[model samples]
Target: ALNKRDRIDPLEKQDSWKDFIYNPRTGEFLGRTAGSWASFSLTHPEYFLRLWVGLGLVASHCQNYNAGRTFCQSRMVSQNTGSLKRYIQASFCLSSSSGYNDSIQERNDLCMVGEYTTQDNEPIKKVCQFKRSTLRQCSGLPDPSFGFKEGKPCIIIKLNRVIGLKPEGDPYINCTAKRATSLQMQYFPSEGRLDKMFFPYYGKKSHPDYVQPLVAVKLLFTKEDYNIEQTVECKVEGSNLRNDDERDKFLGRVTFRVKVSE
Candidate 1:
């Protein structure tokens, strides 16, 4: 009797992309993808669906069905953003991207702030307009002499608060709105940043060495590209690193992404 079992279950028919009244017993459609049921198909699917669960989006099922993932590749595996925010606030350690024991040790082997040792620190936050004039006004930066004649004033950026060993602005940097999702923000260490790396005065055999604080941070967001390059003041409020010998330096500036409304 069971030998007569259909090669394709009724659920498999969901791949047809045709609507039908759902039946729980005869066949089963995945509740996750409301539009279709689950089943093996005659041919490979050229297109698929993705769902946004707030934290991340699902692209498709992994090819290996029995790979034994929670939803069989139906989930968006990612680093927790909350943790990222915390790490932003936590302790940090840095080193010269260049190695220490090189022949030009004095030239390239300066000790710098190491990796961000902790992400548990209090986070900084900010919101800035994407428009040119508005973002310039927000950070009290001088208005640009040329570029987009009129700024996209309606644009905005929402971000976690940040900190700085030294602060150029009290809060967040500005952004550009009404543009593509790609956005970039550039900064000089004198004012704001994520982590400022200080080069140890390697050549300074004497006590009064010139070791200026330098910060380097790179941020890419998957949201709004509101303001492209206007500077905004990122607000920083947090305690210093636990060790007095080392400073958990955060440059008080960031490139931002728009937080879209649901």
Candidate 2:
């Protein structure tokens, strides 16, 4: 889009950007693309929405999987899918690429776990916000595991600062991230299954039929490494754990508390 706006520029051109909106036109170096402003200009609202959504799905996966490299490379989006089959498979743990990880997401002698709701009589709300923290002091950074289920969620509070905190009831799954490649198949994990997983995505809800409009955080994969950037894409259509309502929120996107890997 804006980050790489020339996808449909007047003159045929291409750029390297995964985040931004771009204008569309007829006939480009890539090919004729359905422009958001051109094709959906007069179509029904749903039609326009559908077009944008389809493209969005492709973009998110492209950026996340290839470190923001897809259409820009192949220039041929034969189809849009989430299956690990259609794309280049990742065979190694993302940690192998640690040459790029330096942010809070990659902790030093830290456990890759999230906080659970600190309250007993409540499920974490979509609006509760707080500071960063560590759940336990493990001797070394153990491989992480994660899960999302219908349970109490944890609040993000600054380390040792129970200032506005009063209770601890949320249930959280400790986690570590892996490259989308390692997750060859969707294996349901328990309390701490993804400890060594390459791409660990655990929320309070793991069921594919779950609907989360506003949860706590969104966890996403980045190419630069060690970065936890705030994103607006929350859900993807036909996502394993997504419904139509939650599509526009975190499509191809997940939220988590990264300690600023860099």
| lDDT, model 2 | 0.24
Each model's lDDT: 0.24, 0.24
Candidate 1 lDDT for residue 198: 28
RMSD of 2: 18.6
Candidate 1, residue 188: how far the Cα is off, in Å: 9.3
> What digit string (tens of lDDT, one per residue) describes model 2 on residues 6-42?
3466433334221123324333323424564454433
Per-residue error (Å), model 2, residue 71: 11
Q: For model 1, what is the alpha-carbon lDDT of residue 214? A: 26
- List the lowest-lDDT window of 10 residues for candidate 1: 49-58
Q: What is the TM-score of each candidate against the true structure?
A: 0.18, 0.18
Where is model 2 more than 4 Å wrong at Cα? 1-96, 99-243, 246-262
lDDT of 1 by residue, 14-114 (tens): 74433334344435344323334222211211111111111111111111112112221332111222221111100111112122112323442223343
